[model samples]
Target chain A: SQELEQSPQSLIVQEGKNLTINCTSSKTLYGLYWYKQKYGEGLIFLMMLQKGGEEKSHEKITAKLDEKKQQSSLHITASQPSHAGIYLCGADWTGATNKLIFGTGTLLAVQP
Target chain B: GAGVSQSPSNKVTEKGKDVELRCDPISGHTALYWYRQSLGQGLEFLIYFQGNSAPDKSGLPSDRFSAERTGGSVSTLTIQRTQQEDSAVYLCASRPDSNEKLFFGSGTQLSVL
Candidate 1:
């Protein structure tokens, strides 16, 4: 079975600080997605990176996928209080089933 | 446009009881998914439905879990013989297709005591 491992299970940073979260997979990832969940709210889709060595950015957040398709990273530039949430990474499997396996998630807290 | 909506924001039930959670996807969306978020298990995928196609039940943890989608719009997830481990937030999401962006519901917080 495929699995995703996320680093720094919990992080707290002062506002305007930079932070990075990492996700590594034990199996080759076909497509990777990043989501953010606020307290008592549903997850919001952030970005998706498919090809290896691909990079995508939304505002201050940038995500990168490794060429080997085994690892990915999410970087936050000048983090804000709004960036505080539980960040999760998921990988989609190929074929008809096409189920997504999610990581345990990284809890991020950006203080004022 | 309305995003995904779930019913009964919270549920509290005794162990061994059965509970049902409902999800209303956005209009015209063809793909819907169910997921569980527990303290120990984190967030786990449960099942996915795409239009009239057969649902993928491989992610279900046990036989007590089942889900059904009606008219390709609304979905219901039923858990029988619930245990304390079933205490968590059940989230629902829908996408235009299996590989498209997902819009999630606020989720139902289930508590088994």
Candidate 2:
């Protein structure tokens, strides 16, 4: 089984502060996905990176897949209270038949 | 529905009882998935259905857990003789295919007591 480790299990930042979360996998990732969730709510899809050295950004949030495809990072700029939520990194387990293996998750709290 | 929909937003069942959770994927979607989320843990992959065929089911924890997708649309995850450890949120998701973005349901909070 492939394992994904995320750093800083939880974080708290004041509004307008920038922050970053990292996701590292035990194996090379074929596809990396990002999702955000509010407590007790469904995960909201953010972005997907399929190629090495790929980078995608949505609004203030940006995600990048490393050249080795074994790590990824999510960066938020000028964060706002609305950015408070749990962020999860998922990977297409390569030969695992399309089921995404997910990381433990990072909880973000933004104070205004 | 606009997105994946799961039934019984919350369920409280006694230990050893059988329970079935439902998932209704978005129309026209050929891929549906079931995942379990325990408190403070990541989303655990449970099962995947692609066009009525389950090419992967290794994520199922035990024989007590089984899921079925019918007509390539709706899916049901049943836990036979549920245990206290089964207490968690059951989430359903769907995507266009293995390479696309996934949309998830709010999930059903299951409490086995």
- Best-fitting candidate, measured by lDDT? 2
Task: Return the lDDT, model 2, position A7.
Answer: 77
Candidate 1, superposed: residue stretches over 4 Å from native: none
lDDT of 2 by residue, A1-112 (tens): 2389987799999999999999999888899999999876778889999999999999999999999999999999999999999999998857767777788899999999
Point to the candidate with the largest TM-score.
2
lDDT (10s digit) by residue, model 1, range A62-112: 999999988999999999999999999988756546677789999999999
lDDT of 2 by residue, B1-113 (tens): 88788999999999999999999999998888889999977889888888856447888999999999877888999999999999999999999877788889999999999
After TM-score superposition, the amount by which residue A104's alpha carbon in candidate 2 deviates from its true location, in angstroms, is 0.5
| Fraction of the reference Cα-Cα interface contacts (below 8 Å) that each candidate reproduces | 0.67, 0.83
TM-score for all models, in order of appearance? 0.92, 0.94
Q: What is the lDDT of residue A105 in candidate 2?
A: 92
Worst 10 residues of 1 chain B by lDDT: B36-45
Model 1 clash pairs?
none
The CAPRI classification for model 2 reads as medium
| lDDT for model 2 | 0.90
